[model samples]
Target: MTTLHNAEAGDRDRKAFDDPAARGQLIRWFVSAAAISVPQAAGPVTFSLLALVLTGDTSGGAALILAMTVAQVLGAIPITRLGRNRSATWFLQGLIAIRTIALLLMAVLAAYGAPFLWLFLLTAVAGSVHGAAWGYLRSVLNGLTPASKMPRALGISATLNEVTFVLAPVAASGLGSLSPIFAVVAMAVLGAIPALLVPHVSVAPIEDTPHAGGSVLSPSILLWLMCSAAGGSAIAAIEIGAVALAIGFGYPPALAILFTVPLCLASVAGGIWVSVRNRAATRGMVVGLLCVMTGGAWLAAMQHSLALTIVGAVLIGAVLAPLATYYSLILDILAPPNKRPEVFALLRTANAIGIIFASAVLTATSLSVALLVVASTMLVVTLIVGAVSFKEKRRA
Candidate 1:
């Protein structure tokens, strides 16, 4: 009986995707995902170069990035809430337009020798919309694809995002060589593609029912969010500290790619694996992925040998997509239907917070120490998850 029901559901999912309109929207969403990801993937380098051009210091660039991240974390929920009564696609496009205008304004002002402070403020303006924009985009996905096919859809999106990260940096560097302001302009232009490309979908109105006001931050929701944060911090540590890791391994700064490239390649492979499998991970599998990531962080931190460290990086990369996809899928189930955008916004904010945590730790300590701290955090989170799961199983 269960097998028959499963087969019938699978057929329904496929038939939904078979519709020409649905397929078109999915394709558009894929392009939009890649488009938006380009700016984020290239942001650190582009902003750093912009700082160098304006103030002759890269630290200001990091500050700008921090300001943007902080603003996104602070603004995500409220901004998403404001759009509750509006069309998701329209709101998302508006947010993207706002960000694009801010980026363009910053570039124009930089050309006119604007104060670093003005540039900083503009960066914040652009970043404040990121989380809400992402939430709406995810919400749009919910409309374009059926629930049973969501894993595959998210998997494809993840794969594109990984590819964007792989290429965006190189593109930024190439464009930055001409002019950092030009690179910023290009980033803004590409980032705004989603504004134009995102297809319109009918948004169901949230009826004024009591359950519509349910809290989005239940303990179960927090558990998955904490998992996301831990994973983000662990990954950020490696990416942000890649140069340090290379130097400590007796390689030149230019060879930082030795660590970063392998990690990215592994991540792309992982994304592909998730797309091919197209299934949600079980609780035990989620816990196991967490353990693998924790072990990877520890191994990379050990810095005992170059080969070993690269191996560790690969391990961390290997589980990234599976875990990320699981978080999205599970959170969709846990969040209140009416408050989904807020929950998804918080999901993104959580990861941003994790990046901020990793950045702070790296600034205050050595790369080795930072990685250790990240690893330790992941370990603690993993144990907590394990304990909670054990209790749940016992109750069952």
Candidate 2:
């Protein structure tokens, strides 16, 4: 009789774990988090254009972006630490509120002709809080998702995020056509939606234990971080120089939209594939994808034809979301359970650094040369990571 009761209890627990309502709430939270990323994904292009409009110079835009990236890197750790003991839902709501208010203030300032310096300061403020928002969102998802379902949940989240990346800039550009200030205001309104939805989400309590996993500086984590950085730099290089590439190919600058739309569509498809597979990527697969991505970058940079450019874009985009999904999965394996939020923040910091690196190179060289540099960097880093993984496997 006791054995039967034990079996029944186990079945009950398993059913609870697989509850459809719980999964539905998780999906809702994921959608809300992705919605928040829309404005963030649009930020670089919007701020850059705003800077150009206000100062009649591109350097102003670069400075604004630099300020934001620097602040985000510096603030990620402390902000995450502050929220470490709080309810995940409450913490996320607070961060979203801060971000919404900052963007609204930015819109007001832009509408009223605020000074460039003020705009830069506000951008930095918004960005500092923004890093923690992403960290907490990931943490919330971690707490809500079962280990067995993590890869699928993260894959779906990544796909939605790719959708945001695809639409945000296009939306910003469309709104900016009428008024850049209008774009800022619209993003501000969109930013508040997540805050309203956070209260309905539930998270499992994560036990704060010391015996979680290896440090973020461990070889596995470092290798994944480097791969993430390289991928980010490659993507940033393409995004930041798309307009210039369009002009270089004798097309109108507005045709830059053509480069991004196809790339994003392919990314969405790749993300869906990852979700459906619901499996973690192996080291061999990572290396192979990086090689493909590098080859695509080279093709895009070397070929001047519009047709080849679009093909190259598609090739790179096809691998990007899958690569990101793999990295998140690897990070889950490498990071301590208790350290997930901060570790995720560190990944964002690494990506931000890569963006800064690409931006600096673009400022110093032609778009083609900068792209070659991006591709070369990715190739070198990927080869090093592959070697490290091979060595580790051999030792194992």
Candidate 3:
């Protein structure tokens, strides 16, 4: 039965993509989504360089990112709800515009030898709109494509995003070496592409939907959100700590890509696999993926050898897309139709929170300790999700 449903869904997706108009809109959204992801993905490198220029230490960059992420978490739902009556394209554009302005101003102020505090505030301003922008961006897809096409659409988007994740940091590093301010300006300009490229999608006010009053964050929903955060933390621990991991492995900081590049390539492969498979994962599959990720985290944490660490990174990366797709698809099913923007906003926010958590741990602790903490967290989350799945099945 499941195979038949997936086959039908694949057929529908193919027919929809066969339409040039649908294909163009989806292609544009893919580009826009990739653009929107750049600032955040390039942030650690960009902000780290900027901080080094302003202050002698690089710690300020982490502080700025934390401020931005926290503000995003606080503003996500409220900012998304504000757009309930507006077109997703319009609202998303405005949000991107606001962030672009904030980033540009931060760059300008930094060039003038402005106070670091001023730069921090501007970073927060830019970040404040990020979660909502992502929410509306995700929401806009629903209008352009059918549910049957989502797995492919999301898989392709994930692949693009991983590519961005892989390349953005390199771009930021190269640009920042020339000038950190230039990198910031580049980030702002690239991020604004979404505002121009996103297709106009009309959205009905939340009040009009039949499921307008349904809860957005029930237990089932929280379970997936928790998994999303756990995955984010594990990934962040590796990416953000890549330099340190390299140093521990007796390599120069520039060799950090040895760890990061493999992870990203594996992630791209995972995304492609999801696209080709073109189906939602079953409960058992999800649980299996969760366990794979947990094992990956533990492997990286063990740090017995370089080969093992790289293997761990690969394991985690290989499962990232499938699990993330599951979270997004499940959340779409569980959330109120009218409140999807808010739920999706929370989804991005949860991932950001996980990144922040990893950042915080890295700040006060050694890389070894932080990896241990990340490993433990993923293990606990996997266990909890497995337990929940078991209970739900028994009830069914």
**How accurate locally, in lDDT, is each candidate?**
0.88, 0.77, 0.89
Better of 2 and 3 by lDDT: 3
What C-alpha RMSD separates each model from the true structure?
2.8, 3.6, 3.2
Point out where model 3 deviates above 4 Å: 1-15, 203-213
Model 1 agreement with the true structure over 79-147: per-residue lDDT tens digits: 999999898999999999999999999999999998899988998988899999998888888877777
Summed backbone clashes in each candidate are 0, 0, 0
lDDT winner: 3
Q: What C-alpha root-mean-square deviation, in Å, does candidate 3 show against the real structure?
A: 3.2
TM-score of each model, in listed order: 0.95, 0.88, 0.93
> Which of the predicted structures, 1 or 2, would earn the higher TM-score when compared with the native?
1
Supply candidate 3's per-residue lDDT for 206. 24
Per-residue accuracy of model 3 over 1-396 as CA lDDT, tens digit each: 979977886687578768898789888999999999888888888999999999988989888888888889989988999998887788899999999999999999999999999999998989999999999999888877777667878898899999999899889999999999999999999999999999886553222113434677777777888888889999999998999999998999999989899999999999999999888899989999999999999999999999999999999999999998889887777777778888899999999889888988998899999999999999999999889889989999
Is 1 or 2 the stronger prediction by lDDT?
Answer: 1
- For model 2, the stretches where C-alpha displacement exceeds 4 angstroms are 1-18, 48-62, 199-214
lDDT of 2 by residue, 1-396 (tens): 979966775665456458887766676777787887766777766776776777777677567668878888899889988988877668878887887788788878877888777888887887887677777777777556655566677778878888888788878888876777778778777776778765344444232213347676787788878888888887788777889988888889998877878888888898888889877778788888988888878777776688887787888888887788788767766677667777778887888878888888998998889989988898798789778878978999
